[model samples]
Target: MQSRPMPQVAGVEHRYVVANGIRFHVAEAGAGEPLLLLHGFPQHWYAWRHLVPLLAAQHRLIMPDLRGFGWSDAPHRGYGTNARVDDLLALMDACGLDRVTLVAHEWAAWAGFMACLREPGRFRHHLALNIVHPWPDHRATIRHAWRMWYTALWEYPLVGGAVLRHWPGFTRYILRRGVTGVWQTPALEEFVESVRSRARAHAGQALHWQYVLRDIPRLATRRFRHQRLQVPTTLLFGEDDFAFAAQSLDVGGSHGVDVRVVPGGHYLPEERPDLVAATVSELFGTMESHREEIVG
Candidate 1:
């Protein structure tokens, strides 16, 4: 494989590991508790560039280009949500990470939700950004239907790939329009180019198609009745996130879910890394306080 210059972030190291049969390119740094950061569509681990430097000072950060994104292998198959979760689990096994604090955004949040539910003990806490839990409210989804209009275009196979390949501006347009704070930059262009790979483009489309075809149908049937998240969870959303409505994503009053509406938009990690880092630090501080209380 030809080596390409990784996006620079001070003190971060890059490596690759075979997890669940797929080789993953991971950017890691720091020490102490393991913190796994998962990036969303049209982005690789580089999406966390701003947030990583701050978090790396305190935690052993493990940021991977989720399966098909970034420098990771874009396989012809294994784009399913469960498969992604399995990949994380395998990565943990390969790295000897028995437990971790999970931080994820967008599509990766869905997989994190499942991983936390599946093995609650393995995750100390979950700090989810700009995405909702699995328990979808039909009425809320209906009311916020306009928010997810982009999914329609990506749910098809060839159509999605064609637009991604031919229309270079389409992905960039989505990122620019999605965020309230950030303007066009080199990072946005890099992300747009990452998905231009036919394999990654197909993987992105498959993700959307699976949600519509497999995930939604299962949700309708209450397939997740057996799953419950026991890990402490904090869901932070941007007030202006174009994809998800802040009001509609209230999973509060449920066990272990804490939702906070912050000032910003969809790309919270990039748009407001300070807020993201502070929120995470507070969560960890609270956890430490609780531990001390238990010890005392």
Candidate 2:
């Protein structure tokens, strides 16, 4: 319900826009074509901090704190991925964005996939970072499921809040371990301290809870099979990511997505910002030019 002071990132403009009945905190930077940056758990727009400076010059970056993270108003409800997807679509509408090049990390990457699938017109190109694709092979994922044990500690209702509140070390460990020793002092501290807020803790819990209860079932049921990713997408999977192993995705289901395994851990934005920025430029920059040519 209350927002804490956000650390100042040079040239990054922070504003609160009313969308989905909540005041979502958005961090905007750069110029040129629009690029939407959605972050993952235990992090907000700051997750894109490392990437912002890299991509700020050539492209406009619109980074938003998903419903309950960062300085955004963390309401009790609207924690599920579908709800987050809706929140983003509404946020874009409120901001007058007809379409954007999506650069999303972690769970937000998952939701970004869903958004592109449901409405291909909303996204020009997608650069998904360090998350499994929508059509994950159930058998392969289950084999790698143990890697996700950490989610249980923070996915439950009351237990997750207690973990974030009482023991900040656990949260710190999760943040640090996700990156391959690339994370520095203040970045980890920023995310850990943000989730320490009671409201933010609740928001974190609800986000994970929805994942465990709702999204997992959808994955098991092949719910996404009914949908297809029409947007041009490149899925960047970190080779040493703690959350997922080498995925065995369904060949039939993978049509538009191009999955590439890169060097690093889960946090590509921090560990491999160079690769992230280059890929963003390649995907978004080229697409913008092609669009201009067609329109011109």
Candidate 3:
């Protein structure tokens, strides 16, 4: 299963653009309202391969390699949530997309939340996969921190990069961890190899480092805890995911976030792209219909 050859999508066009001072590789398909899909750490645009064809029929899909993953430029810095959101905003500007519906997985989910929080009007709706909200109950997260032991390994500056660059098995193991079904596929292989690159290793580690060193402290402040979500959001969590418990997912329930328990593991984008695409399509349609109702 891991050895299967993964082919590129038939009608998708691959292009590169300068955004946030770095060259970003993007895969686009169809033509309608733009649906931007942001991938998580150790993955890029290719993670959305299955969803591209599924949703491309009704909406234009823009899937980029973020900044440091896939074929995108891996600069020395800019791995923070704010930085990544800025990159996405700049990419939208470069592509002339004034607004977009966002579907993000893992780390990129954080960026999506931040983007919507900072500029609510920029996004129509957000569908987040397997990630807790940016502002969560501190007590709940602290108790479940053990599940994130793997992230601690990534927080280190020296050994983290070494593990990614030298040990390909590490990436493969992490991607396969806790996921159901045959773990290895062509896309999974490509993702494993991408993180094996030294550049990606550095950038990936920096992502975790920023979360631990910067974001965690910010979470303690009144500003971060009081920051409310301004966009309609649906957070899907895998029932079998070990990294996050159900408690963390429900922290923002009071703020109108819909937390659903989907059957999968941490890697929902790859393991269950069909579910992801269908869910997003339904959400998009619902949001559009509500807008139409208001106008009427």
What is the C-alpha local distance difference test score of each model?
Answer: 0.83, 0.86, 0.82
Q: What stretches of model 1 exceed 4 Å from their correct place?
A: 1-4, 225-227
| Candidate 1 lDDT, 25-130, residue by residue in tens | 9988899888889998879988988887788879999998887788988887788888888998999888889999899998898888888988888899999999
TM-score, candidate 1, is 0.95
CA shift of 184, model 1, Å = 5.4
Per-residue error (Å), model 3, residue 272: 1.9
Candidate 1 at residue 34, lDDT?
A: 86
For residues 180-275, write the lDDT of model 3, one tens digit per residue: 766657767888787766788898889999888877777666345666677889998899887888786666477657889999998887788788
Clashes of each: 0, 0, 1
Ranking by lDDT: 2, 1, 3
Estimate TM-scores for all models: 0.95, 0.95, 0.93
* Candidate number with greatest lDDT: 2
